[model samples]
Target: NAGVTQTPKFRILKIGQSMTLQCTQDMNHNYMYWYRQDPGMGLKLIYYSVGAGITDKGEVPNGYNVSRSTTEDFPLRLELAAPSQTSVYFCASSWRATNEKLFFGSGTQLSVL
Candidate 1:
């Protein structure tokens, strides 16, 4: 089974363009997260969902949004993308929040000009 999958491995956008990064997992995990890593920095949580229909803002949520409509799918949306948002976005999933290892997707590299 596919642990986690992210579509559009790479994308380039104009200053104001918008796009969605799709994430899906086959492990039936209840906890999923979105993280962004800028150049020369560690991953920063952007959003997360504990379960279907339950989502919360993370450390850096501005200009980004997410929805969890099913246990296997969590999609992140970028509205009015900006150059500052250029980064490598990762989607991870785990069985539970505590003491569980996360399974991560390859990542989606986004660039805005």
Candidate 2:
């Protein structure tokens, strides 16, 4: 089974362009999250979903949005991309709480100019 998948592994965006980073998991996990990892920095949450139809903003939600419509998919949308938004985006899943270890996708490297 595909544990977790992310599309367009790499992307470069103009100052104000928009893009969506896709994520999917076959584990039927109840919790999913979108996080950004800057060079030498720990991951920072952008958005998260506890289950299908439930979503919430997290630490760095400024330029990102998310939706959870199925047990297997959660996507992150970036609007008006900016240089500050350039970072490695990771989609992760866990069957339980944040205290548990997470299963993460390889990551999408984003660059904004």
For model 1, the stretches where C-alpha displacement exceeds 4 angstroms are none
Model 2: per-residue lDDT, tens digit, 1-113? Answer: 68999998999999999999999999989999999999999999999999999999999999788889898999999999899999999999999787788999999999999
Let me know the TM-score candidate 2 reaches against the reference structure: 0.97
After aligning candidate 1 to the native by TM-score, how far in Å is the CA of 74 from where it should be?
Answer: 0.4
The 0-to-1 C-alpha lDDT of every candidate, in the order given, reads 0.94, 0.94
lDDT score, residue 15, model 1?
92
Please tell me which predicted candidate would have the highest lDDT against the true structure: 1
The Cα error of candidate 1 at residue 49, in Å, is 0.5
Clashes of each: 0, 0
lDDT of 2: 0.94
User: Candidate 1 local accuracy as lDDT?
Assistant: 0.94
